[model samples]
Target: MSMVNQTQVHETRLSDAVNRIAPSGIRRFFDLATSMDNVISLGVGEPDYTTPWNVREASIHSLERGLTAYTANAGLIELRRAISTYLTKRFAIDYNPDNEVVVTVGASEGIDLAIRAIVNPGDEVLIVEPCFVSYAPIVSLTGGVPVPVPTEISNDFMVEPEEIVKRITPKTKAIMLSYPNNPTGAVMSRKKMAEVADLVIEHDLTVISDEIYAELSYDDEHVSVPTFPGMWERTILISGFSKSFAMTGWRIGYLCAPEPYASAMLKIHQYAMMCASTMAQYAALEALENGQEMMDEMITSYRQRRNYFVKSLREAGLSCHTPGGAFYAFPSIKETGLTSEEFAEAFLMEERVAVVPGHVFGVGGEGHVRCSYAASMSQLEEVVERLKRFNAARIGR
Candidate 1:
């Protein structure tokens, strides 16, 4: 006789926070775009160039030397020292390599750790609207409230100190800052950064500054908010090799902060993941040392592409503010009477060109779209022609 089983069973249960998070809206469109034929994709934020030869050679050398074992929790000491030196040389930000820096898997991990380190459940994290898509979901996953403050094309998408000051309440714990910003490509000025630093000091709030695109500034110099007096102690500065060195797949990033907070973040780093890849760390050291020439060349190309793409979009009857930094151009397409998603879809379907809907970035982005100019000049030229044809048809209809 078959007897009924009497054993107790257990099943996997995902955290409610995980359930609440949506897959990246930026990525969702790319996945759909790839299945189509003859698609000219400007949807991705990746650099179209291959990783520089020197950086690739360094990684290869590390692998040949069998430097594949797990690294120390804070990452390779040499890589940390390289990071500290690079930031100091480039941004004039001071950080001690031994105690104050932790190499993360990527800036993405740095964001997670910063939010998790300081936020207690129910605390609020302030974000700027038309922001990178990850910040809100990551805050929510850390059990913190995500408070978005809208910036505008009129102000060039730069946040005002007063807007940040007003967003604070007793529950507000920290602010997430990204400059040479993704999607919008807006940059923070030194004076504005100082104002933000002043506000943070007045309220005694922490800052998670993501400067991954720091090296991509086209027309302006990038500033670190932490350089302002008293802010070094209150800010966790995040940057990585991905954007500057065209090393996205390598996934090497670092965080710099003062004292107990740094220690707290390192604890999370140690437990969750021991370190970033060993070879990648070695390769990042080379990237920090020998990659500046490559970066300067790439930046020069990106600037030309930026100028060309913005002109092309305007010629196509779209209004886009020329971005000050990063590789994306966020253009307003509301005149087409299409929602951002519908506009992106129709653009792709009709012109065989892929650009992301700006709403995917956040709420204030409804009438806009983001296209990366990181592609080759030839591709950019071709995309512009397709857009012009698409616009002609759109206007006729």
Candidate 2:
């Protein structure tokens, strides 16, 4: 009788969408590095700097005042107002704080909300390749096809309009863009961005533009997609304080779009997230108001690091394009005759340095590996020494 139990055995069911995507390749290497001792990691893209003291104090003050309750579904009105003001001041874009902005948990959440709001099942979303790894998987989770439009290092990694045009189809719904782009550190020139903008207008497609690294642009003024003619109506702009303000743990990001789209994203935000943290909102408000000097100092440091690191990589016998923005150095490892994953693993094991395999970033990311320059200069100097040794060994082998 004990052996003839009536309960039927059933395997746990998970969403096919969840099953479809692979675990993040960035986190895999980061975790492997964490498990080791005295490892100088260039794997994760996080800023090594801590959040500014004034911003932290603002959050602490909010807690002292007993402001721990949940905010409105759209987030604190004051924070929204600050965000609207900051955008207008910094990027010359306008959004009505009341109805056009929704504060999200992070720029990461803003991406998720924007995709889920607009992407219908079976729709196709064009993703710029060698991008932040989250984009394609998020599109796939919504049952939308993630079509990668690859950019090349030889072309300075700028997206070519003709390539995008080739990928266009009736099922295509929107295009996802990130300039001061992750992994590649490519920033789209305004002239080039305008060309892409023209295509979006001609096709009547929406643009989900993630400008989280907007303030980190080193070569030229960062362009906001919404600033282009006809783009304001169609672009859902996403940005945050993570990279620029060293506020990654605060998780404060926002979405700005037209009323209809904002409302839709708000609906999803209300149900799924309710609201972003109240304390973080206060902290974000302070950052927008008074964190400019500290942010500028961080940017200056990153620029210096970028110059030294890229030069160092090339001198060490790897072909690295000088990044126009962001803190990553994407160098071709193809000369070693090893895949990106193999190189990253072997580099980590032998040299005690950690860099992410570029193939994880989607098409066109292969034959390269992404090394972050966000670590200390001393660490970077050591990384270059080890890289030189590694390259020499590979060449000799």
Which stretches of candidate 1 lie above 4 Å from their native place?
A: 1-12
Please give, for residues 153-265, the per-residue lDDT of candidate 2 as tens digits.
99989999999999999999999999989999999989999999999999999999999999999889998899999999999999998999999988999999999999999
Question: Measured by C-alpha RMSD in angstroms, how accurate is candidate 1?
Answer: 3.8
What tens digits encode model 1's per-residue C-alpha lDDT throughout 79-119? 88988888899889989999999999988899889989999
Best by TM-score: 2
lDDT for predicted candidate 2 compared with the true structure: 0.94
User: What ranges in model 2 sit over 4 Å off?
Assistant: 1-12
Model 2 residue pairs with clashes: none
Give every collision pair in model 1: none
